[model samples]
Target: MKRIPRETMVFLLCSTFYRLASGALLVSLTWNILNQESISYFPLALAILCSFIPAFVTPTLIRRLTRKFNGRQMSARFLLGLAILTLVAGACRYDTSALLVTNLFVWLLFLLLEASLDMWFTQVQRGLAPAQVQRLSGATTASSQAALMIGPLLAAGLTPLLGNLGFSMMLTAIFLVVAAICHSAGQPPITSNDTGSDTKAQELPLALFIPMLLVWPTLGAFNFMLPVNVMVQGWSLLELGILDASFGLGMALIGVLVIAGVSGSRLLAFLSGLLTLSAAAASAWLLLPQDLLFRCACLGLLGMAFGGARIQIRAAIAQRLDEAAVGRSVSRANALGTPVLLVVLLIQLGAIATAWALPFLMVMLSIALLMRLALQRSQPHSAAPDATPYS
Candidate 1:
């Protein structure tokens, strides 16, 4: 393995810590909301929809923000703000309206921080060779997945001692503070060339966006269903956390082994679609009669599939677009897919088990098949002899 750069190492460390905290908070928040007597699926779904509002505009927002503030400064500020918001949310956890409002802001801050980190990653990739970019991207993704795997375990251990709100507040503050320190200490100088030249922008292939459109909703629906399943099954919060951790482990393993090794666009897309379909199937199975071990297996499979698909889709997009266009292309994909998520959330809110699960599974499978066809059709036209490898 090549020696990782100091800046990259710092960035990855901070990102990993942030991801851990975010993952824990996600589980804790869902558990808390579901456990509440007054809370119902509608409000929770609405909150989720509101949370994704930032993703719809992330590309435009990041573009303008990066012009005024460098990635490090922006990320640091967002982290600090997020820390403050998290504390406030924890303090007001008993108030449903307050929690909902606070969580929305939390997601907004989180997305902004994500945008800054992604922008920095893109800029950093611009300074590396293609092979290095692939290795670094895989390593960074794997590290984040590792954090995600650990996060739920931490949440499970801490929730008993500190309570859900207290755990969330403490974890967010600690991790965000460390992340802020890392960002402040290792702030990279942004050169004028960090943004791409003003040459005519290349058209991003439609096939590149297909996976994002299909996979995100599948993942989102799985997340929505998991907490509900836990609630219906009368499982403990710790079990929920563990299940989430299992999913994270699956993602981490795939990131390290599969996505890191694969390179061809068609192959990546095919794998991404296949994994997504598998995740959806697993999610549907989770709603069926099964032993504890079987359920756990399904959760693990879901995680692995979701993780593998996510990395491949990202790799596919990166392989096709210039570094500068990556942000916009991804943001546009998210924007287009946002409504799909809203619909999925609404379906979940209805709490119709078979209706939602069956349709979701069918749709996921259909999309996966379509994406495979799309990739196959586009490969002949798009693949270049000297094209960058996606591995």
Candidate 2:
């Protein structure tokens, strides 16, 4: 794969700043709250739903927004807004009732920022040759995961020292300052209509998009509740940090494997789906009263399956859609799946109320994930032929 330009690297680093802020907040606030069991299924579900709902409209919104502001400017505006909202949320984190309301707004702000980032990065990747997509995606994925790994590690040490509210305040300040710096370093706008075609071109119908969107919910379900369950099961913060780190490690490791031999073609998608089933199976077994080493192995394996599938899925999308449309497509998928993930996670928590249900839910999520892969394979490739390996 060809290397993306140096300008693109700067762009990606700025984009990753938002995630770093999010990771800090999540580790400080969300993880601590889950440890206390103060955040139940209902509130968590509502929060996730609110967070992802914007995905549905983000694509269309970004399409128009990018046309007005260049990718860099749009991202700067998003970061500025996000930084402000995060500060406000941090200020109100102590007020239980008010915090919930603020959290809702925070979720909305993040959704907007994330959707915009997705769009911005998609544009960057689309501009690259087909061979470059895989490398660029891998690099971005590695950068994001690196932030994730660092976020929790920071939280594990800092949270216990500063306490939740104090750490949250710190996080808020960090995000606000970093975002400002990134905004100031924004790049010039690029030409938007690379295709040179006007609105007269026929657009792909939403019906064709729904199946792809469905994959989000399956992933959302895992993201929403996995950490909470691990915390609930009496795992130490350090242990949880390690587990989260393992997830990142698995993703990075699998990305390397893909560069070596994994095909992003249709055949690979089918195999990825079948492999996901094994991940679920391992997760289920771990949930069922297992040794620590065994559980760790399962979690790592689950992350591996996700790593392989995620790269393939993105590549598939990049192949099918235009460069400008890639971000919107990803945002749309994330938006559509948000509610489904929230609802399923809620149900899983309810089951947990009766007993330790992590193992069973792992089994269930595995089934759903596998089904998604199969569905992806059965669906015809809708993307126009492109040389980009990362969608």
Candidate 3:
């Protein structure tokens, strides 16, 4: 067996920790606070919005930091910030007055930190061979999703014994600290090995912008559509949860295959995911839209496609950009995509009576395909022999 790289291993661990704190732990904390009537859902909604306020500064901050810190150093800085914020948030566990403020800062730091980790991972992946990059990124994505699943179960088992506030905060802080430590350890000297500062990598690709603008809302359609489907059909929340889990299952299944050294074209990966999603949505709407079992299958296929698209998109970016440029490009893509995603979601939400999943999927798929084709024609980059995926 080939030895896994130190940087990749650390990245997987950090990814795990990030998902736990961001997804499970925060949800747990919010649920507890809501149970106590210490805070309302509206403020929590606002907290989420405010979190992305820092996105405006990310491109500039990352560019300046990339001049000095290696990938690990950049990740460690943000992780350490997240650790501290997690500690501070413990005080808001039951306090009505502090809950809003704590949530605001904690979520803000969490997002910024996540973006930094994306930068780190992108930098690391570009250094390895294409096959190795596939395995490692797949492993990391799987580990992250696993953590989200495992964390809530762990919280359920532990909350009874140790209580919520102290246990959650302490464990989250410690977990983040460990992630930072691991990411910082086994570091290779930059002068000798790292190429994150390559001159060609400094410029963000022009092709990425329009395509990215289309990508997010299309991918995010799954999230908005599924919930509405459940509401309209009067399906059980348990079934909804299962459907969600099925999506993750699809992603993990694909990741497992990639980790086993399966390879394929980047362009195919991206397109197949969108097409699978479109086909599944079309099938579900036409045939078994209300059948829980069939719906689960469709969601699973959609997830697999999404998983493939995610891997290829990041790899494509890393193929062209250095650490800072990758950070700038991704962060910008996310920021721009977020608003369009929100708009699409809100339009759907406002017309819940008419927001069928099939139409949404078809429209987004069309836009995504057109933008994807336009970008491909302009760049001519995905044809790199190594960028080719499964034969």
Task: Give the alpha carbon lDDT tens digit for every residue of 26-51 in model 1.
Answer: 77666666555544666656666777
**Which regions of candidate 1 deviate over 4 angstroms?**
127-131, 185-188, 191-200, 213-216, 259-288, 319-324, 355-391
Q: Can you write out model 3's per-residue Cα lDDT over 64-137, one digit (the tens) per residue?
A: 66667766676676666667766666656777556666665665556456556767777667667766666676
**lDDT (Cα, tens digit) per residue for candidate 2, span 36-128:** 346455555555555566666776777677567655566677666666666665566655555556555565556566555555566667656
**Candidate 3 residue pairs in backbone clash:** 263-389, 263-390, 264-389, 264-390, 265-389
Worst 10 residues of 1 by lDDT: 192-201
Candidate 2: deviation at residue 89, Å?
3.4
Question: Which wins on lDDT, candidate 1 or candidate 2?
Answer: 1
lDDT, candidate 1, equals: 0.64
The C-alpha stretches of model 3 lying farther than 4 A from their native spots are 29-47, 88-90, 94-100, 155-162, 189-207, 210-245, 261-270, 281-299, 353-391
Question: Given candidate 3, what's the lDDT at residue 105?
Answer: 67
TM-score per candidate: 0.83, 0.76, 0.73
Residue pairs with clashing backbones, model 1: none
Best by lDDT: 1
